[model samples]
Target: SIPTSAGSESDAEQLQEEQHARSVLRETFLRCLLSISNKKVQFRMHEKVKVDATFGASDIDVLNFQVSDLHTPIGVQKEALIRCQDVISFTFDV
Candidate 1:
């Protein structure tokens, strides 16, 4: 049971609306990622790791990214799956 004290319920409704807006924004971001498929992108991760790879696709939950030709210190991997949690951000040319 929720207490309705001086417009508290309205405050809760406003919070719910804000959450829905955030969800829509997140879906839009995921769609943007999909639109950038097969493009060369640069990723920045922890430990100041920066590498380039061909963007394939990300899981529905944005957990992991399927990529190819992952450039690393040792060598470039022919195929790779980068964990999204490890990535700070990524960028590619429009």
Candidate 2:
């Protein structure tokens, strides 16, 4: 049974690793969005503004996200709100 226990532990570790990777990918996406939104020039008005992101674990697990600017409005006061929403949505697979 020791070998079985070890296998279970390894599976847990792998899951943890995948979760961490996804978390990192989500964070990177949010940072990129913030940097882009902070640019001095205004984004094109009424543009579709689609953002696509993918996080994968080897060949099995994958998380894909596609968000439009219309769904997530970015502005001065809304920065934190937008980031929170994006992070939460990405983290929870929403």
Candidate 3:
């Protein structure tokens, strides 16, 4: 039979808390990325813009987003241009 000790229960609770913390951090990082993307889009609409936004856990993955805009006027008419790239890679251990 397994022993019902206070230490074991405490260990289990600690592990659960760690897992929850990791999950919350991951979610918050993702939300930050989304906000950065939106800001990049807004910047592109107005003028020629370039931005690099990077985020994420070291062991999991590193995300680098590059955004730019190129405007080409058509016969003296205003034009709009937008470009974005999301580059991701495994970086280092956490």
Candidate 4:
């Protein structure tokens, strides 16, 4: 279904609210990452590929993951940065 535009003032207010909500969500996610730092976590990627690593940290923009001792099929990597976009999901023991 097609939607019509509201007044500029209303649109601006809505956009501001959306941005604020996104900011809050990002902050929460960062805090969660901090809690998981230095923990062993397994990332699940596409095609059912899974890799285990010692979680180090993440960039502010959540663009990449800093991990150590990454266990892949071919070999174990001493240190690597996993692209966040390639990860479908991940899990760790709390």
Best by TM-score: 4
Q: List lDDT for all candidates, in order.
A: 0.93, 0.39, 0.41, 0.94
Model 1 per-residue lDDT tens digits across residues 49-88: 9999999998888899999999999999999999999999
The sequence of per-residue lDDT tens digits that candidate 3 reaches over residues 51-81 is: 2223211222542333334222422212222
TM-score of 1: 0.75
Q: Which of the two, 1 or 3, has more lDDT? A: 1
Off by over 4 Å in 3: 1-7, 41-60, 69-94
Query: Over the stretch 29-54, how does candidate 2's per-residue lDDT look in tens digits?
Result: 67554444322222222344432223
Q: Which pairs of residues collide in candidate 2?
A: none
Select the stronger candidate by lDDT from 2 and 3.
3
User: In angstroms, what RMSD does candidate 2 have relative to the true structure?
Assistant: 12.0
Best-to-worst order by TM-score is 4, 1, 3, 2
TM-score of each: 0.75, 0.34, 0.39, 0.78
Give RMSD to native, each candidate. 3.2, 12.0, 11.8, 5.2
Query: Candidate 1 local accuracy as lDDT?
Result: 0.93
lDDT score at residue 94, model 2, on the 0-100 scale = 22
Best by lDDT: 4
TM-score of 3: 0.39
Residue-level error in angstroms, candidate 4, position 53:
0.4
